[model samples]
Target: MKVNIYYGGRGLIEDPTLYVINKIQDVLKEIRVNVGRYNLYEQKNGISMLPNTFKEADAVILAVSMEWYGVGGLMQTFLDSCWLYADKQRIKDIYMFPVVVATANGERKAVEDLRGAWELLGGRVCEGICTYVSNRIEFETNQVYASIIEKKAEEIYRIVSHKAPMLPNSINSCHVEIPSAGIELTPQESEQLSVYVADDSFVKKQKEDVEMLSQMYKSILGKKSQPDSEDDLLKKLEKAFNPKEASFKAVFSINLNDVNKTIVLDIDDGKLKSSYSSSAKADITVNAGKDVMSKITTGKTTFQGAFMSGLITAKGRLDLMRMFDRVFVFEY
Candidate 1:
């Protein structure tokens, strides 16, 4: 039998989950079960591609270390990838056992979440391990804990080898029966889509392609393209300037539907300037789509207000961006 162990921990030296899995692996090895271990932290960049590893496994151990809260982000991401990419037919046959080692509370909750996620993906969830180990030294050295890990490994081997049968679960029943809005995509297609979605450049390129196609359609329909009004926007920006006591440089990345480009707003030396730039560096990166820009242009909303309302998304040096509305008073 071939079993895969996915360790969703930071690989800390003192992690109890790591210790438990190591012991379990030893027992599984002694039983002559082919075991493959994947440390999620080491494969963080290629996590979306990891689901392909499930092709050959008879069973999988979804191991996680709950330090303070629930299972960490790495584990959650792996499960999301599985849902998107793993072949549902293949997953339905494979068995999953969740092993959660908790440093704080919520070990039971994390295990339930892992089990539910696998079952919802049409996989069979087997009996698994859950424990709390506050003291690493005692937990690692305790023979009782070691024995428990070994026994659990044997139990998993028996279940997988025998193709154990389990009773129906209400959660799986509800999830399968309920209708959810989603496009039907093959595992390979879903994997490709997930990878593309995670890639900023690829998504931007797709948007540019779509915009180009839209413009072409408009031109074919005898609609004349609007003349560039970059100068008008710059003039309004200049007139709206209200210099503050403090001086700082800020760059704004603005996206407008009228133009298939990013407009940069550079503020320095009490002067406001606007230009089209793709590689411009900024202290604060702001994304104002066409609608948000309209609100700003009509003086119906402030930058801060737009951001708070989720109309605008900003990253990096946000405190500096907070001063944007103070320095630029838009005229209605």
Candidate 2:
């Protein structure tokens, strides 16, 4: 069934909360569910006024934050705009779920506001999940929240997977609320909260890198196996191309941008090996462990941002880097 998720928020002011929301999408995809996600921040009006892709979806989940007992300004505007469609029956039949990111102090208020908004739109209000991460939690601790969000996402998927053929008139049947806080944040204390907003510039760069690397890996992995006695450099080339029978090969190398690293990939087997050792020319040749390489190739890292920030570098044949796209096909 078609599934669409709408994420409306201001910015990445809190890393933990943002991490949780982002990871939830990954979890849904891992289970083979087709999901279309839209971030209100990137849109011109913060709401898709045109009939939303969510129209035909069996379920539509909205991820927004509560600042005090109210929805964030951006999210408020977005919801108000959505009334145009929801009121007209565009998304009237879709099951609606809300996920609110909030701090322990403001959790109740935030959730209440979200419920009010959901009901206002003639949408069913599912149980809401609240994720709390203290301001003191280091950004590195975000993984913890990611896991929590993933678990919450799993519960949501399960609910939608087995939803009653006809939802009851009541709106609370499908809500799953989670209120979390670090051990230090006592139940009584009021803590300021933040959500991690992905760097728009970085996310765009990362998407490009992931696409490039994914293509490279697919190409090399597609060819048949060759002899072990193949030239040493040729063997390395083949290994890079056909690592463990992967369909593509992504080679991380130094990039021209001081802030980013360049990824070179071999998408399909061609005669490129004929010029093996001329200079081994790639700026900052990277020899990543298989696991690390896989992550990079799969777009788990912000390659351009990493490179620009000095996380990656190049040494030779930088100009030939653009050849990657010509080598492999993008699967998605």
Candidate 3:
């Protein structure tokens, strides 16, 4: 498995975060993981193009130092570039592990922020290292600390190699649109602009070309690609129905998290009635993001598998919930 490490910390002699990431990288390499490391401080100029590196990565380590209150400007800028220029569909399939070492405070919050940002992009998250160090020499020299770091790295390697399933996160419920300066850039164009950003002649010419027209288009070209329509999803849900004789009657209220809509399935023996509304109370209330629901509809994931993985959540009669896939059978 290929694992990429993006170190957002400045290379300081006293930065324990640097030491931790090095240890993790070493452990990962010892296990024969194909590893790539990029120090963002050194490559600050090319960060806009860095997202393209996700192409070969099965998982990534987002290591940032909390020198003060947050994950620092470099990491934040890198994340912003990923949201604006990266192929988000590619990001969704990769796993992210966050490593934060704080000299002051807020290491846990920084990790949370990293996880939240990645999840907003629809990626999986693996557990990572978060710690505060008072003395860098003491922290790095300790054998126990080294052992723990080794184990975490090993665990991350195993997870990525296995292509593990993760519980769907809360970020699935909310996201902000990535605003564009002008046209939606292809990755190559985005990389070219990073070099052009410093050239006055190129900047002036590009701005002149986009000037008034940029405002006219606003975010028209940058708007997020939408998922399947509510009607289309509803039809798929209905079409997948496979009546079961054992259950006398059942009602399933499913919330499509991303679209902010709920669909109700009222099943009475062989008959089925499905519709959408803002509110729908039922015998079993299921909750999942649009992607998860699509998988269920397409028979890509079973209802039980979704529930067990926490991709699809159900409230009320969980026993009745287990019978859902049986009645509304989806096939490959």
Candidate 4:
């Protein structure tokens, strides 16, 4: 009788999604159901470990805010993490209820996406909540709205308690399987790995170890290790920097498939720091081919130009991308 609620909305004071979940939580508590809640915003660092929580949950509520057109990235990341690390056997039996609250448009589409995702993960999709509320106060104060939320909670309780039967879904019937992350880990181990993945210091240490090993192997083979062209580019970026503001920090993820490595650049107050690693939290993340990166570093192409030409892809804050060119005017 344990139900988990993962809130995938930004913690806004006036978010209607928060109001609805709170109401549902209260009703579930009154019915003596052991309810647990996880706010994805507060757990961004260890989202990859969250799928471990699914082991004990009989049912789960995937609640998210459709502020723009789709479910926020945090929820989508959580779902991706689950696909990568969760135990599919356990997921197949768990019931999933989607709670989508929209402040703009696309609530219905978001709901469908969530349900389809859950079903694809082999979870039972339950009829859940979906609505748009331009006026949070009005929606929260409406008695009918409150009643509907309470009824939904009651339905979950009865269905879970009685071991409700779920109709077959064609997607699940196809026996599609997602490959695991290739390693089995306990919950504690998964949490530790996730923490290490997000910790920049830990990743740096690992990179140092790898570099040391590479140098040793090169010496044993009687050959010199090739100079890291990308590393030189990073130093060049630092030398060319022109500071605009007093204090600012941003991380850029540059993928170089030629060297089979990803470079992370951390700029703090116009001071440049570079490493060969990954960061779960970055102001802006870019995925570019080696040619695109080479062109940008050589000043043959600009960040904006590469993006417009579909040579470089980026996500996160757009402002950071614009700021990069101003800070570092690359000259070949």
RMSD of each: 21.1, 16.3, 17.4, 21.8
Clashes of 4: 0
Clashes of each: 0, 36, 0, 0
- What is the lDDT of every predicted structure here? 0.74, 0.49, 0.77, 0.77
On TM-score, the stronger of 2 and 3 is 3
Please identify model 2 stretches exceeding 4 Å from their true place. 13-15, 46-51, 87-90, 136-146, 165-332
lDDT per residue as tens, model 4, 1-332: 68999999998998899999998888677646789999999999888888878766779999999999788899999998887677777787689999999999789999999999998888999999999998998999998888788768767876665456788879988988555557687777666445422334543564575566446434433632333377676777677777687587888877766677787888888687788898887877777766566566666656755653445655555446667787778884
Ordering by TM-score: 4, 3, 1, 2
lDDT of 3 at 322: 60
Shift in Å, residue 204, candidate 2: 37
Q: Per-residue CA lDDT of candidate 1, range 229-269, in tens?
A: 66566566677878784466677766654466677778888
TM-score of candidate 1 on Cα atoms, chains taken together: 0.54
Candidate 1 yields a Cα-based lDDT of 0.74
Clashing pairs in 3: none
Q: CA shift at 283, candidate 4, in angstroms?
A: 51
Off by over 4 Å in 1: 174-332
lDDT tens string, model 3, 196-315? 222345435535644543442343334434455788778987888777684568888888888788988888868888888644458777888887676667666677656644466555
Using lDDT as the yardstick, the better of models 2 and 3 is 3
